[model samples]
Target: MTQTAQLSPSSVFVVSGGAKGITAECTIRLAQQQPCKFILLGRSELLETEPDYAQNSDESALKKCIMENLLSQGEKPTPMNVQKIYNKITSSREIKKTLAAIEKTGAKAEYISVDVTDTPALQEKLATAVQHLGPITGIIHGAGNLADKLIEKKTEQDFEKVYTAKVQGLENLLNCVNPNQLQHLVLFSSVTGFYGNPGQSDYAIANEILNKSAHIFKQSYPSCHVVAINWGAWDSGMVTAELKKVFQERKIEIIPVAVGAQMLVKEMDNTNHATAQVVIGSPLVPQATELDSELRTYRVRRQMTLEANPFLHDHTIAGSPVLPATCAMTWMINTCEQLYPGYKLFHHQNFKILKGITFNESLAKEHILEIEEISKVSFENVEVKATILSKNPEGKIHYHFSAQLNLQQKIPIARPYESINLEEDNIITTTGKAFYQNGGATLFHGPAFQEVTKVLNISPEKITTECLWQEISDKQQGQFPVQWINPYTIDLSMHALWIWTQHFHQEACLPGRVEKYEQFVATPHNKPFYVSCEVKAKTATSVIADFIIHDRQGQIYSRMLGAHAIIWSMKLLRS
Candidate 1:
């Protein structure tokens, strides 16, 4: 059963670091959504009233008044002393504002002054609050301190302060509360922890500990809604003007306070309890800037097998699982996408399946994919050559697949689809069931690869068909998992050509080469889509055709032009 956090008017929440900043903002939003009692914890002591000299004064004016007061008292009005007074007054005001905001939402609010790292002190204080407020139903561990410095320059004290406030603080809170009774737990981690940043080694280490702990906690208490949000730089809170400017200069996206607070509320209400860690913001470092600095060749080795890749079982030929041509394209393109971090495959040319891997018996082998930059077609576009090959124990390399890939940093806009005229079509000769039955034209394919719903119309020159969205299960996927370019869907679009070949030439065929292939949008799976295959040329040995997968409105999803299929021996047509 899906688990969702149950928050009600009687829910009592203990929030560390909830008296100020982003935590306070989210706390207020939660109360607004469901009126509840909140016990806020912080180290800063709140003043009941502002001093007479600090009344009606802004930060700059308040600093001047503080300096003057120090001078009149016969003490040195140094910059350090002035800044200390400024911080105390500002922190007090923020705490007061957060309390008032919660009260305005018709929720009970109380502030406690205690250090989370001081375990005994925190336990004593929380025990008292729980006695009066009933029981703690939730906890938001947001008390984290940052002391950023290079490893060489950092002191022991610097590490202790930042690490204890986050890691030790959470341990203390969990120790004080009854873990099984708690319904919700949110830990505010950071992007620094997820994607390490310079001069923040200690801070990142502390947050990563929280991230892992959250997973462990969820496993121990399956009923609890636990999540550690790896937050990016925000527009408010710890990001000071100087730090904000630095993040902006680095092109790091900042999460606005309103959007982030709403996201927290939504996450708490989400029923997917299995998700323990969620990264809420963009990476601290831009991928394009980091990878574009170098253009180098890359070689990746992988093990391929039917046992590891059960998806191929659905695309069998002659009762033996064989790798589909479209899947090879996906493997090649997926590898190319990794070489350039932020770029995606825009188009590919001359994609050929030279050799096919068939799982006739217990089959397992190692394969290598080599990707090399062939051309830099300006800064926005690039071309790369990719090859998939395997080497035997004797060190003989067997080429399997190769393609020229075109990658673009930006997604290209889709153009209007060229609709096909099926006015003079023949009668429908195949239904989805008949096509997949024994002795059928598609007898070589299994249920998973049989995506064609029905042959709507067929002729010697053109064939139109309807295709189903083949849902792939996780276990069947094995090693060759499905991604954006679904092998089954693309193969369905090409199936029209195979059907035409069987009807006209009475021959078995295999996809040999594709001159060009481009995908503009992801194929919609909510409903069936149409595919049109038009034969441009044909011979006794081979046939060339063009295919397009589109919707009823003529909105194209993908297209392949100049696809050449090789005529194979009829013995290989059926098992």
Candidate 2:
């Protein structure tokens, strides 16, 4: 791909996460070459001029971040509080310079301080773009946040800070803009998410989500040229001197700001002639030796969320999405595979869902998913736990989704969520969307919650269907760090069982609680998969069923055990 494919004169672009760092550098350079109208957004509101503290020696990046956090919490901000205003003031100066550079190139540019995760505000910004710059032809989604901590020590806020910008921000941009007219959707991802990092679980997942999103969005919106670049750490903006030294020690090279800008221009030309995802810089492969003492306890930690994982928001019961036990097992087994490569999950025991890990939208605004290993590995075996954790204003940890996963080897392969691939030609394919839309909105599922792809078989004793994860680009969105459907997908899948029950019971039934469930193998999101359910037990008030999520080669990605469900009355709708 040539680095000289600059935008045409009439090109209008909207870029999130562009106020500073590599994104800001790209903004200035893109305008210099392309001379297009650019809309740059940042979370921190910047003014037109630099403040007095901008020239003071006491101004440091840390001080600026502290002031920004305090002001976000509404601690009574004022320009008189130069300590509070200097960081923002400096950011303003940088933004002004970039805008001026863009203008000097005979281009028009403006700044709008808005949170990408805030859907309504993003829509308003989209409206403003239409009003001023006309239809948006390009969108460089470069929004992201940093919260580096070991999985155990990380808070949900840490997770959201990183994701809301990248994951949810992309969703907001896709929905608000004219998809048909969009020519380029460039997402700035990171290498950490593709490989693995000791203290950057949340960061990894957030970027990985972008990687998968790029491919799926390409398919969903054929007119839009989409690509996600899994970038390495940059020398300017976010990379501090201390962080740079740490990155150097890890064998990760810093990408020059100028080089990255040119790369963006090259990718916009659809360099490979396909909507592809690529990584520019390389990071060292993760090793046990790299584990800091805090994370060295044989227990590994990983974090996830709806921003980079919007599918979690889909599966709802009585109105909230709950974590499926299989999702927890996937986390545990994947963590073990990371520690013990060349080995998939052989066996798991005592795998129980202690409580439903609800991915509530309101709660998610301030929290994230944290998976941690509680006990050390036993030869050929391991144990881990999953939780939704956050820190209170007082700095204490708040926890949820408590579950245990025990991993071991040398076991039989025959199990649920495990099956031979049924030929697509033989399977009776049906839209799960029709099921939910025709009935069960009260089941707390809209279009996004429709997980079933095809029905394989249904009878009095056994019923089977495919929970093929066809990425739904309608309504709300989802994260891309997924190979299989989330817990909500698993639970919503059992709705097949309830649908089959309509042959006799004549009413809907909701999942009560997971009696036992575990992951058999890790699944990737971009594959075709299916699920099967068998009747375990049924009673007057409830029923129990078993189910699994697997792919064509019969590779079992996840399984559910003794899923308990209760009869629920719901109003149905039909087209």
Candidate 3:
């Protein structure tokens, strides 16, 4: 790094969206150390007459807001939250007021109103600014906005609106500005891009683009010092009252203007250019859970019962109900699809059943679905690990199921089905003797989860079944929030192969993993359906198959490419 260099008298800085913002605060702070002329660019013009709200009456308006905040806290105005409100309430026509404040510090300042996204227009204005204010050397791109909506609610327009200023604006500036003339370039990014946030996915994605761009520019333009500052929430910007409460709950400290600006100056002055990307605030990204990664409260507690979860009462072995692994996947898939609208679960890897979920007559009142972030990754893809836990009366959390999900942003409309064709009379049917030792007309399934009425055919090569739709119980229907098929029926259809496994492999077997699964339609549950499984790969110890379910009319409902299971007797440790 070069010796602490001071701003030269001829230095001219172009601050985008800096006409009136925390960027203005940083400009004033820069003036305290060394004087430099600033051309502040923004979308709004500095009016000859100040806004009606900027009248002397606003001083009272500001006080009124602070007083209400203090009343809610049941204390007098403290410097903390009061400062948050004070910074936000200031009006923007104060652009002229800001220029005057900077001039008082012996730094020249002027305002220019133009859309930063307008490449041609910005080029012209930038050229004119150089003519009036001398050479353009320093650049601070603070031009960005927040739409702040969950991914499901975010429209394409909202993404574009938030993206253009930071991503596109930076692109245009790099194209228009002469790299030889530039000494310092500052890109204002955020911690959300580094980790991940719930409502700010779009914004986080945009800033991430900026951070990558800054690094690339640094390597290409070796003469210019390109630095991307990933900042925490600042006191003097677009942050509102409600957002402040959220930050407090998450324990994210808001960077005071003076400190934040001072840090900005020091970072810019680092002449070595070794630091391409610098995170200013101490951002503690939570590794424990998904909501934690998003700065939200993670724990979810709910009351669940046999009546509420009718599917839970469906399959029982030796008088104990077992929750199917696929049933849990159903809930997780439904949820994530809603949370991230455009993303689809492409594959499920390493699904484990630690202990089966069993419910007595009283039912376990509360169970928790722990959604944790294995990693906050990729602009278009995310991966998460989930656990289904039950709290016992003694207050111990019992884990029932766990799995890793592979998510993709692009949604697939259809996939090739595994074709299975056979003669009706050639395949032999079996009764309860194969599944239950009692050898009656029933196995482990109750009326609701028992969709496979009869085995149409069975073999090592293929397995097909005849199924009748057991009307989804009103009590259980809400549990399947996904508009398509419910897990109960899907699990029942897959259970048809249980008889095959019992006869050839062992007395009983359980699902080990689902390598891949896909769905095209939420097939109607009221109509009779056919589910056929074709053996993809097989071994003496394990079996893998592809399954496809279709209604009588041949409309495909769901498909599984790599469903696998282990032989029940093979895992037995004792005779």
Higher-lDDT candidate among 1 and 3?
A: 1
Worst 10 residues of 1 by lDDT: 285-294
Best by lDDT: 1
lDDT of each: 0.82, 0.65, 0.70
TM-score of each: 0.79, 0.48, 0.47
- The TM-score measured for candidate 2 stands at 0.48
Error of 2 at 77 (Å): 12
Candidate ranking under lDDT, highest first, comes to 1, 3, 2
The candidate 2 region of ten consecutive residues with least summed lDDT is 287-296
Instruction: Give a tens-digit lDDT track for model 2, residues 222-338.
Output: 656677888887778568899888776556788887888887776675544453588888654443232222333343333446555555655555555655454554555555555
Model 2: how far residue 232 lies from native, Å: 1.0
Task: Give the winner by TM-score: 1 or 2.
Answer: 1
TM-score of 1: 0.79
In the range 1-575, model 3's lDDT, one tens digit per residue, is 33323467678888888867788788888876678889888887556764333334366576666767578769777667666455444534467778888899888987887888998899898889878898788788998988998799999999999999889888887776677778888899998888677688889999999889888877777767788989988886466889777677556888988899999888867767675788877563222223224522134556655666665655655555656677777666666655554456655666677766666653567767776666554435667777777877888778877777656654355543436443464455553234333431224556666656667677787877777766764566546543444676677677666666664655455677776666666656766778887777767777777778876545567777677876555223111
Global local distance difference test of model 2? 0.65
